[model samples]
Target: MNAESIAIVGAGVAGAAAAVRLAERGVAVTLYEAVHEPKPIGAGLLLQPTGQRVLAAMGLLDEALALGIRVDRLFGDTPSGRTVLDMSYRRFHPEAYGLGLQRGALMGLLWRRVRALGVPWACGAAVESFQQDGDGVTLQLAGGRTARHAALILANGSFSRLREGMRVRQSARLFPWGAVWTVLPAPAGFPQIELRQRFRSASQMLGLMPVGKAHAEDVERGINVFWSLPVASLDGWQERIGLQPLKQRMTDLFPEVEPLLAGLTEPVQLREARYADVHMARWHDGRVLAMGDCAHGMSPQLGQGANMALIDAHELSAEVGTGGTGGKDDWPEVFARYTRRRRAHLRFYEQASRGLTPMFQSDAVVAPWLRDRFFGWGGRLPYIHQQSIATLAGYKTGWLWGRLKL
Candidate 1:
C-alpha cells in the first residue's frame, strides 16, 4: 500500500535479506516460500567477508558473530596430518576473514528480521503460475491465493518454477563424487576442531568442521563432518553407504581428520551431494527478476553459494533504491545492467571453483602431487592468497557496492 511493493519468492536467506533491506528503505515487500514451513536442515556454512559485509549492513553482524566461531586460520593438510599450507584470516582481511555457523541458525536470524520488519509473507503457498500484465505481475498460488506486485524476485532455490518464464535451464550432473554430512554433540572432552583439509591420493576429499552446537536433543552439541567421496554416480546415493563406512573410509583415507569423525555418534545423510547448475540467459524479464540460487545455482566447491546470494540481494537493493535503470514501467535496461554487473564476477568464481574440483578428484599421482606443490608454493606467495580470498569473497570486484565510485 505504500512505496513500491515487491514480491520476493522463496523466503530463504536471499529473499529474507532482500526483503529486510528493502523494508528498511521504506519499501513494502511480500515474501513467498514454497516450503510448508521452514525446516531444520543444512549443516554449517562459511561466512566470508562478502556475507559479513551484507550482514553488517543489515545490523546482523553482531548477532551472527555471537552465533558463529571465528576461524583464526585456514589449514590444508595431507591425510597423514601433515600441514601442507596454512594461512591466517586476519592476514587476508583487515576487518574479518571467515566464520562458521549452522545454516539453520543463519536462516532463523534472517526470518526473525523479516518478520520484525512487518514484511508480509505467505509460506506453504507454492506458486502454481504467474503472468505479467501491463501494470504488474500476477502470481497464482497452488492453494488458489492470488497476489500481485509491481516487481517480483524469484529467489525460490534452484528449482524455481517462477523462473522458468525467464528461459532458465537446469543441469543435474552426478559428480564422480557424493558427500555425507552430519552433526554430533561436542563431547565434554572433545578435541578442539582444527580446520582440516585431508588430501588423499585416492581423489577423495574429506573435511570435518566444528558446527559449534547441535539443535538435536538426541545428539550432544558437537562438530559437523562433511565427507566428499568420488562417486561415479549419485543414483541411490543415499542408500549406498552409511555413517560407519563413511567414517571408516575417511579414517583410513585421511587419519588426521579421522579423529574428528570418530567423535561423531551418527551421521545424518540429510541431502544427496549431487552437483547442479542453473543457467539463464537473463535473470530478469520486465518487472520480474530472479536472484540467489534460482538465478545461478553453482557447485558447492566454491562454498560461495550463500555468499553469492547475499551479494545478489545487496546489489538488487542498491539498483532499485537508486531508482533503478528504468521507471517502474520499463525494466529491460535495468535487468540488463544488473546482469552485466554480475556476470563477470559469477564467471570468475564458476571457472575457479570448477578448476579446483578436478584437481581434488584427480586419480593421477603426478597431477595431484603437482597440484599440491602448486598450492604449497601459492601459500608462500602472500599476495596470491590475499588475492584468492579477495576474489572469492567478492572484495576485489569493481561492481561491489562499496567499490562503486558513483
Candidate 2:
C-alpha cells in the first residue's frame, strides 16, 4: 500500500483520462480494470470543443483530428422533408466544429498516453467493494486481493455495483429506449461534414454521421449509422422481426441510407446500447468520489457523455494538484471543489437531455408531432438559435447562464 498513491477503478474513457491527467501532474496513479484485455466499447461519438481542449492539453488532439471528420452542422428532418432541427457550429464560432471519431481510435490514443506516462495499469483487477475511513480507503478486489490508497475514485460506469455501497443519495433508471448502432464504409456522395438524421415520428429514428476511419491503415472513410429501438424490443429482435423489416423501415424513411445498410447482414453487426438517467445528490462521500457516468449519466440526446467525462478528468486532476498536497488529509477539500466546479454544467445537461429525449425517442404519438411542428421555427429565433448552438458545443453551464470560453 502506497500512502501517497490514489486508486482509480475502471479503464474506460473517464478512468483512462483521469489516470493520464493525474500522472502528468506528478501524482502516483494506479488504474484497475475488470477485463483481462480491455478495448473500447460502442461505435462512434462526436467530440466537442470542450473535449478537444482536454485532448489538446494531453497532447493528443492532432492525432485525434487526423482520425476524425470535422462536422460543421447537425441536420435532422422528417420523412416528408420537413426540417425539425438544423443547428450549425458556425453559429457558435466561425472555426468551431465537432470531431466525429471511432470510439476505438479515441481509446487507443488515451491508452497510449497512459502507457507513455508510466502509469501502473492493473488489468483484470476488479475492485468489487471498498471501505473508507478518516485515514484512507481500502479496496477489495475480486480475488481476495486488497489494496490501500489515500483516496478512491469510482469511474466504473453508470451501472456500477460499487456505487450502490457509497452511502450517497442516487438513482439509476434505465430508459425505455435505446439504440443499435454500427460503423460502416461511407456511401459515395454522402455529405462528409454533416451529421444527418431522419425521424418517423417518435417511434423510428435513424442517424448517419461521418466518422473518418477506425484505423489509419484503412483506405476508405467510414460512417456511423444507428437506429432507435425500445429496450424491451432488443432481446430476440432478429428472431421475432428479423433485420429485413428493420432495414425496410429505415430505408422507407431515408432511402439514401440503403447503400450504407447493404452490408449489415447479421444482427451481430449492430451493437445494442441501453442508457440510464443517473442522479446523485453529490459526487463525493469522505474518501470516495464518483466521476464520469457513475456520477451523472443521462440520455445521449446532447451527445455530451464522453466530453463531460473528459472534462471531469481535467477538472479533478486540476483540483487535486492545486487544492492540497498528495495526502489523504486534503482529499475532502479537493473533492468538494471539484463537485462545485462541475455542478452547474452537469445539471444543465442532465435536465436538458431528460426533457428532450422523449421528443425524439418514445412511444408517445403527439410529442413527435409537436417537435416536428415547432422545433424548426424555434431554432430560427435569434436568442434560441445561439443558445442552441452553445448547448450543442458543450459550453452551456445552465439553462440561462454560464458559457465556456473556447
Candidate 3:
C-alpha cells in the first residue's frame, strides 16, 4: 500500500467520485468494494443542478446529459385531478433543468472515470472495522486481512456496519414507508421531459420519470415507475397482494399509467427500496472520516441522496487538495473543515425531507388533505415559489439563508 494514499471504503457514488477527484488532483486513492464486481444499485434518480456542477467539475456532465432525460418540471396531482405539488426548474433559472437518469448510467460514467484516473480498486475488500492509530487508520477487512492507510473514508451505503465502530454520536431510523420501483420502456404519449405523479391521499402514490437509455447506443428510452407502500407490506407483497391487484389499484388512481403497468407480469419486476434517516453529531472521528450515506442518509423525498454524496466527494477533495505537504498531521483539520462546510447544507435537506415525507408517504388522513388544499397555493406565492424551486434545484444551504451558486 502507498503510505500517502487514502483508503475509500465502498465504490458507490461517493467513494468512486472521491477517488476520481482525488486521483485527478494527483493524490493516490485505493477504492474498496464489498462486491467482487462493483455495479450500480437502484433504478433512476434526478440530477439536480448542484450535482450537475460537481459532474461538470469532473468533466462527466456532458456524457451524463446525453444518457439522461431533461426534466423541466415535476408535476403531481390527486386522483380527482387536483394538483398537490408542482415545481419547475425553470422557475429557478431559464436554462435550468433536472436530468432524470438510470442509476446504472451514472455509475458507468463514474467507473469509467475511475479507470481513466488510474485509481486502484480492491474488490471484495469490505472493511469490517477500523482503528485509528497515531497518524493513520488500520482497516480490518473481512477474512481477517488488514490494511493501513494514512486516512480512511467511509462511503458505504446507509446500512453499512462499518459505521457502527466509528464511535460518533449517530442515529439511524428506518422509515415506515418505501417504494417498489422498476424500469420499463417509455410508453407512447408519455411526456418525455416531465416527472409526472399521482396521489390518492397519503397511502397511495405513483410516479413515472423518463430516464433515457442506459447506454448511448441503446435504441429505446425507458421510464422509472415506482409505487409507494409500507415497508412491512413489502415482504409478502408478491404472494399476499399479487401483481394484478396492485396493477388494478395503480391504474385506478392514475389511468394514464395503465399502459406502462401493462408491461408488468410478475412481482419480481419491481425492486423494493426502503429509506433511512441517519444523523451524526459530527462526520469525522480522528483519522477516519465518513461521507455520503454513511455519514448522513435521509429520505428520498427530495431526490438528494446521490446528489449529496457527489457534493460530499467534491468538497472533500477540495479540502484535502492533492495530499501535498500537509501530510498525516493535517487530516484531522481536513476532516473537520469538510464537516463544517457540509453541515448546514446537509441539515437543511435532512430536515426538509423528514418534514415532507409523511405528507406524501404516510397513512395520515389529514396530512394529505392539508397538502392538497394548501400546497398548491403555497407553491404559487412569488417568494415561496422561488425558494421552493431553489430547494428542488439543490441550491438551498439553509432554510432562510445560504444558496450555492452553480
**RMSD each, Å:** 3.8, 1.4, 1.5
TM-score of 1: 0.86
lDDT of 1 at 224: 63
Model 2: how far residue 107 lies from native, Å: 0.3
Residue-by-residue lDDT tens digits, candidate 2, 1-406? 5766889999988999999999987888889999999976577899998999999999999999989999999999998989999999998889899999998989999999999998888999999999988988999999999999988999998899899878899999999999889988876886789999999899999999888877678778889988999998987778876889989988998999898898788888988888889999889888788989988888778889999999999988878657546453388778888888888888889999999899999999888999999999999997888999899889999888888543
lDDT of 1 by residue, 1-406 (tens): 2225778888887788889877886767888888887874676777777888888888887877776666556576775555555766676657566767778767877888988998988788787778876567788888677887777788887766667666444443335665666665455565543455677753776665555542323344446667675555335544676657666777787665555554565344445555556667667777778888777776666678888888887776666545443445244455566777777666666666666666666466876677666776786788777765565555654323233211
Query: What overall lDDT goes with each candidate model?
Result: 0.68, 0.88, 0.88
lDDT by residue for model 3 (6-72), tens: 9999898999999998888677889999999776656899989999999999999999999999999
Candidate 2 has which clashing residue pairs, if any? none
Worst 10 residues of 1 by lDDT: 397-406
Q: How many steric overlaps are in each model, in order?
A: 7, 0, 0
List TM-scores for all candidates, in order: 0.86, 0.97, 0.97
Q: In lDDT terms, which candidate is top?
A: 2
lDDT measured at residue 87 in model 1 versus the true structure, 0 to 100: 61
